[model samples]
Target: MNYNLKYYKFGLAIMAVILTFLSCKDKVKNKVSNEEAAISTFTNPLKVEFGDPFVLDNGDGTFYMYGTGQVENGFATYSSNDLVNWKFEGRIYEGNIEASWTQKNFWAPEVYKFGAKYFLFFSADDKDNPNDELENFKIGVAVSDSPKGPFKDLTDQPLFDPGYPIIDANVFKDDDGKFYLYYSRVCYKHPVESEISQWAKEEGLYDEIEESWVYGVELAADFKSVIGEPQLLLRPPLEMNDRNAEWESRSVTSGEVNRRWTEGSFTFKHNGTYYMMYSANHYAGPNYAVGYATSNSPLGKYQKADNNPVLQKNIDKGGDVTGTGHNMVLSLNGGKKMYTMYHGRTKAMGENRVVFIDKMNIEEDGTLIVDGPTTESIPKPLEN
Candidate 1:
């Protein structure tokens, strides 16, 4: 079974509400207190089979979301006024072939708004190059007038593809407006060691295993080209040292995931620290889960979260809720509350990763607490 992240292209802030309700001055109100309301009104919101879920606040009341799609066309977008409900928009753009090495398989399309125009960054492969391995993996740019877009390919050729099998391209801009792209890929194009080849021959070994280290390159002032060499940012110590012995020789390949470490990187700032969540274990098994790391700067040495995995299958139910990672955290209504949006698999749904939203709470120490896919519902809070 082949493990891959499908490409959906182009993908929140909080608000404060002062809600008023009509009442008779003499009547007693059976109002739930804020803490009581929070405990009583929680409901599971998002549901869909997509990865790299990106939520973009349109600056209006509505939010737009985009993720990996089913076709060669770029990513698809969805919109909703309330965080819980969504409406499907269509594919905004498709990759325009610019080089011989780029082919189909668009993965992880991320969109950023720069001034008056919107920019989409996506990964694709070249089908034409036979000898140039560098032409095989690439990232390209597309432009659009709006977030819900009819995005047009901006370059006549791929903006840049290092000629490797690159997947999961994510675009990030610093507070100063510096732009960077992060992704995961194999360590080497060709293997020289017999052990490495034998490992590849294993029933569920990786052709190219994903790692944790992130790479970064400067974006041109126009956001069109890479200004310099891609710099290495992070790599998993477990894989780098070949000490993944605890996980090695496990024969639990029921679905499609092979080997794993680092894939699908997302960044968010919380209480002054930058947090990144990465997936661990094979996506096909119950071991598949999310692990986290944190740093003060976007590019740097990241400290891993506490030993426990952040999200995982309901180990109580034996692969019932497996494959629950590749997620993003969103703030609702100007920091009133926090929510985590991610994907999960259920026995009822078979082997597909569908989106899920759960309200997130912070510990006194400021760490993010993301529990599992819960079905318990609560009453809606009456805002003040």
Candidate 2:
């Protein structure tokens, strides 16, 4: 053997092995760096997928999320310490049990803490649809001792029915120790004549259009019944010439659907004014968006804000976000700062609705503003 040639070949083999080791080390470093970047920031269309997203700060430094269609025959919840990182807590409420009045199609679950108990208010299909209504959704209450719960139905039947299909239950307690429940009446089979309907017919789009409206009523102290009849608070405008009519009628005007929605109602009292923020347009369509009205009382002759549709799709502005509606407010910093928690869709994200927490503020004049439906890296929600 030529010993000199053999020694040269051995040297080359050693160098090649060293190069491969360095390459792997660099790759590992890059992977760690990317993970760190993701952990350090938050973004819109948050990782949690659910429609009608609601976030509740449980007073223990943890936030809980509940929404529609997250689980079968019930609602699923996600918990987060910083609102950016989330852990699935599984289905917290299950319906359609033995002798349970709820059968299926559960949607829009809202939880509240009263005294020592946590109450979950949600909508589901009731068993007593004598005529077989297409969406016989009714609001029901479930209770548990803990926020992360095995919540059980408070009654065999729903809390109460207003003789129609309803969904999206929201309960609010005023400072004076009185409680209120707000919900949306389903638009199924309830067509109302409007200028938009006339326009639709005049344009030969559809013969009629259906619309959902928001209603609010006082809740009994025991959380078992309503103190009075629900009063209509908001709905789609009647006149096509109305300023809000254009944006609110996008679902019909765009010819994507023949329905108008004023559902997903969230209300809060600020500086003596009752502000009701609601979603308009079909929930499943890209035209879905948010708007608000102001009234002196929880149940109101509310006036639609001039600057309505405060948060909506940004596709026209070169962003991929759409279907931005069904919002609930998360109050922090002793109610001085508010975050609007809602859901949206993106071109890249496809049809799945994802949670979005965006900074919202009430201007000095009480104009409500929601800062997003953003896809870019944003400051984490916990950050001041």
Highest lDDT model number: 2
- Model 2, range 162-213, lDDT digits (tens) per residue? 9889999999899899999999998898899998999999998988999998
lDDT against the true structure, per candidate, is 0.62, 0.89
- Lowest summed lDDT window (length 10), candidate 1: 9-18
The segments of candidate 2 whose C-alpha lies over 4 angstroms from its true place after superposition are 1-40
Output the worst ten-in-a-row residue range by lDDT, candidate 2.
36-45
What does each candidate score in C-alpha RMSD? 16.2, 5.5
Local lDDT at 58 for model 2:
87
State candidate 1's TM-score: 0.73
lDDT digits (tens) for residues 188-252 of candidate 1:
34332334234545745555443334565667767667877776664544332244323321222
Q: How close to the true structure is residue 2 of candidate 1, measured as C-alpha lDDT? A: 28
